[model samples]
Every structure is written in C-alpha cells, then in structure tokens.
Target chain A: MTLAAASHGFLSPTGVEIAFVLVGIATLGAALMTVGSRQLVHAALWLVVALGGIAVEYLLLTAEFIAWVQVLIYVGSVVVLLLFGLMLTKAPIGPSPDADSGNRWVALTVAGAAAAALVWVVVDAFRATWIDLDGAAQGSAEAAGRSLFRFWVLPFEALSVLLLAALVGAVALSRRGGGAKGAAETLAPAAREGRL
Target chain B: MHLAYPAVLAVLLFCTGLYGVLARRNAILVLMSVELMLNAVNLNLVAFDVWLRDTLHAGQALTLFTIAVAAAEIGIGLAIVLLVYRNRGSSDIDRLRDLAERPSGPDGAGSADAPRQPQPDTGAEATA
Candidate 1:
C-alpha cells in the first residue's frame, strides 16, 4: 500500500484536492446566499451553512483542531448569539424590506475591487510556494499548543482580558432600558405561571 | 490542493461579506457580515500557516485569537444594537446617526440632529 501510494503520479491531482475544490465551491456559494437571502431567518440559516462549510474546509486543510473550534465557536455559539440578538431586537423573521439598503451595486463594486487586489497580491507573492501535507507541524493540536504557550502567551492572555471586557460591556449596554428591568422583576411570577 | 484555491475562495467570501456589511440596513445582519469576513481571514491564516511550514504555527494561533475577539465583539455589538432597538423601534444603522454630537435645543431636548430623545419608558428617544 505504501509503495502504491508513493508511486502515484507526482503531477496529477489527488482525491483530497478534488474534495477541496468541491467544498470550496460550496462554501463560497453558501456565503453569497447568506448575504443575498431576503428573509432574515433564511440569512441566518445560510450563515450556518457557510460557517459549517468553512469548518469542513479547515478539515480538508488538515487543521483538525481549528476545524472543530470553528464548528464549536462559529456554528454553535456565534449563530446562536445572532439568533438571540434577532429575537431580542424583535426583528421580523420573514422577508424584510430593511434587510438591504439602496447601495447594493456600489457595495458590490467596492467588494469586487478589494477581492481582486488581495488575490493578485497573494498570487504574486507565493506563486512558487507549496506545502507538504506529510509534515507533522502543519496542523497538529500538540504542536499548535506548544507554540501558542511558548511565544504567544502574552497575546493569548490579552485576548482573555478583551473577552472579559466585552462581557461587562454587553451587560451594561443591555441593562439600560427600564422595561427590561420590569421583566426581570417579574421573573418570579413568570416562573410561577410556567409551573401551571 | 492548490493554495490559490482556498485563497481565492476566501477572497470571494470576504467580498460577499463586505457587500453585506455595506448594503445591509439591519444592525444584526451587518454583524453577521462581519463574522463572514472574519471567517475569511481565518481561512487565509490557516492556509498560509500550512504553506510556510512554520513550526510555531503563528498563523493558526492568530486565527484562534481572531475567533475569540470576534465572539467578544459580536456580544458587545449585539447588546448595543438591542438597546437601540428597544429605545427606538428599529435597528437600522441609518437611524443611528444621532450618535453624532447633538447640541441642546430650546425644549431642553437634544438638538435637531437627534429629533427624538430616547425615553425608555415611552419609547420616545432623545438619543439615537
């Protein structure tokens, strides 16, 4: 089996590469659908699909740890938070005229220009670069953790502090309205009613 | 797989997200757009992390940090947007223009820029 694998064509595309292309196309399509969906709920659902596709893309790239993290953080938590935000804001679940403004064309033009520039720069800079998938350091969680704790500890700690601040800020911002305070005050009665 | 394939896909996703950010009026949708862009950046980071064969995997480390920061930012942004929605009746970014400096008016209310003061009880807002 090892001999057969080694004797495989050096220049021909492999199954992994084919799977990568398929997943990439799906992810890109879902991303566009996420932005273009007319219904707010549908947009959120499309976001889930897009995020999940990206997670699969990460897996194909051999970053198993990050792929799972993407699934956990992005697909699980972020989308749920977005749904909570939508509910809290009383956003219409159906099609919303306010989902988009009148500047779609202008925005599309700018986005196209930016994407073109980035692709051109990246292609020009790394045209000759290739990664060896057989290497150990590319995506193993053990190596990632070692490197993270060794040299990137400060930034990692700072990230924790930033998350703490954001927690405080979210609480403060959402606690300002008096009616919500009333709801909190009535929580006991509401719970009692739910018992019935 | 060609690194350009993933890189190109990331760029397309990023561009789509940018369009959403610029074109969407709902604050929550705009936040989702921001998330899309962040995911694109993460894809690029991991791709380059592999391409460079860095023992430290600094790009993946940065991607993790970006994820954490994105989560934090969305939490705070959602809180603010929900507050605005409660105080006013809408979460339109166009309606948030009153966050700019508003001079005082004769009615002891804010200046004409923010024509309505945000009164939480009555939903008559003095602020945007």
Candidate 2:
C-alpha cells in the first residue's frame, strides 16, 4: 500500500490552498484577540476561535479524527466550562483592572526567551529532514482508537488519573473556598452533615 | 515550500501568544494566551504529520490529546480564578499577589469580607 507521493499534486492541489490561507489568517487573528482581550470570558471565547483553527488545520492535514476531537473537547466542553466557572464565581465580569501589571516586562522576557529557544531547537533539528507531506493512513479513528487502547495504555491510564485529580482539586478548592483554615474544619463536617 | 507557510504561521501564533501571556496580567487572558501557544504547537504537529508521514499518525493524535487536555485545564483553571475573585473581590493578577503560593488564608479564615478595599464592578455583559 503506497502512500500518496509528496509532489503528486493530487492532494489539495487547487482552491483548497486559498481556503487554508484564509482559515489560518482568521485563526491567528482570533487567537490574538483572545489573548489581548481584557475580559476573562472574552478571552475564553477567543480561545474557541484559536482551537477551531487548530481543528481546521487537522482537517487540512487529513486527520479528521483529530480535528473532530479538537472541536468536541476544546471548543465545546472546555470553553463552556471556563465560562461557567467565570460566571459561577462572579469574576469581575468586565474589564480586568489588573490586565496590565508591573511584572509584565519580566513575563515578556521569560516567554520570549522560551519561544526563541524552542523555535531554534525545532528548526535546527528538522531543517534537513525529507518529509513526504502526505498524511499517514493509520490516523483514522479506528486505528487511532486501537493504538490508544493497546500500545499507549499506560499513558492513557495516567491521563485519566491526572484528569480526575484536577477535577477533584478544582471542586475542593472552589467549594471550600479554601475557607480560612483546615480542610477538616470545612469539608469533613460538611461531608458528615451531608452538605458537601 | 508549503511547510514554510505553516511554519511561519505557527511561529507567529507562538510569539503573539507569548506576548499576551507575559504582558497581560488578567488570568483569563493568560489562559487564552496559553491556548494560542497550544494552537501554534498543534499547527506544527499537523504540518509534520502531513510532511514526515509518521506511522500511527502520532503527531495528529497527540495534537488531539493536547487540545483535549487544554480544554480540561481551562475548566479547572477558570474555576479556581472565579473562586479567587469571590474571596478577594478582585481578579487582578497584581491584587492576587498576597494569595500567591498560599492556597488558604494565613489564619484559616477565608472570609469573603477581607479588610482590603473592593474595586468597583464593571457591569459589562459577562463574556460567557
């Protein structure tokens, strides 16, 4: 079974290029807006845009399963949860006063250094590699599912644990408000009283 | 080279997101910026997935997982931010200063009525 050749000109050889360009542009713009927005919820909504872009890219790459997962998880579940959390906790609900803080310079320096280093490493490592530019066939949902459940079982289990821990931690932190003192003082009694 | 286009786009997304993360003090914006960075990484992964043609579609599959994990992060992260706001009456990154690394109050009294002055509410429509 021969994979599609890199220079074959059959895969997305026409107007699809234009569509990819437009989608990429829109995605970047939305991501910028999300990060630049002062409001918390607006930021989350913008994240949906950025995530949507990634999904489109996945589709463009011919990884339909990954694309759908991007939409289902990032755009649908995650952003909605973020909004719910923001609303439930009654955040400023408006422009954040601390959007511009004194330490911005320091953060900029750190983030800049990190990005530069990463880009340099990736470019240097892969600059000379010959790539096919055609997606793998095993990327289908069935194959991916089988591989995930079979070879990557340990990592999958670990991820499940990590997610569970995060969920529990979030609920604990939010519900108790970390209420001024010991966990026992609040959670234990609440549990005994069936209030938690 | 077609790879160059995706590479440039990925780099642009990464740098812009980094700026937002570093320069913006709002917690929500920081989270959004992180999402930007993640998307950049996703772009790179998909580009490589298409170009190098790895078996098992490793790059694309990992990208899917990354997106999923990011969503889960936002869910928990926003919840924590909201809880912080309820307690301190402000979501200012600078104002949340004292609470940094100190998950609970100093004396175990995480009362909403802390002695600090409260900021005025902006009354804008909630973004959610």
TM-score of each: 0.82, 0.71
- The worst-scoring run of ten residues by lDDT in candidate 2 chain B lies at B119-128
Task: Give residue A105's error in model 1 in angstroms.
Answer: 1.3
TM-score for candidate 2, please give it: 0.71
Model 2, range B1-128, lDDT digits (tens) per residue?
24544665687689878888778766766776777788788878877877776655677667766765776687678867765555444455765554445565756543542543232322211111
User: Which prediction has the highest DockQ against the true structure?
Assistant: 1
Model 2, C-alpha of B88: deviation from truth (Å): 1.9
Local error of candidate 2 at residue A169 (angstroms): 1.8
Position B26, candidate 2: lDDT: 62
Q: What tens-digit string does per-residue lDDT give for candidate 2 at A42-160?
A: 77777788878878866776667778887887788867776665555455668876666677677668766875766566555554443343435435788678767766667778777
The 10-residue segment with the lowest total lDDT in model 1 chain B: B119-128
Steric collisions counted per model: 7, 5
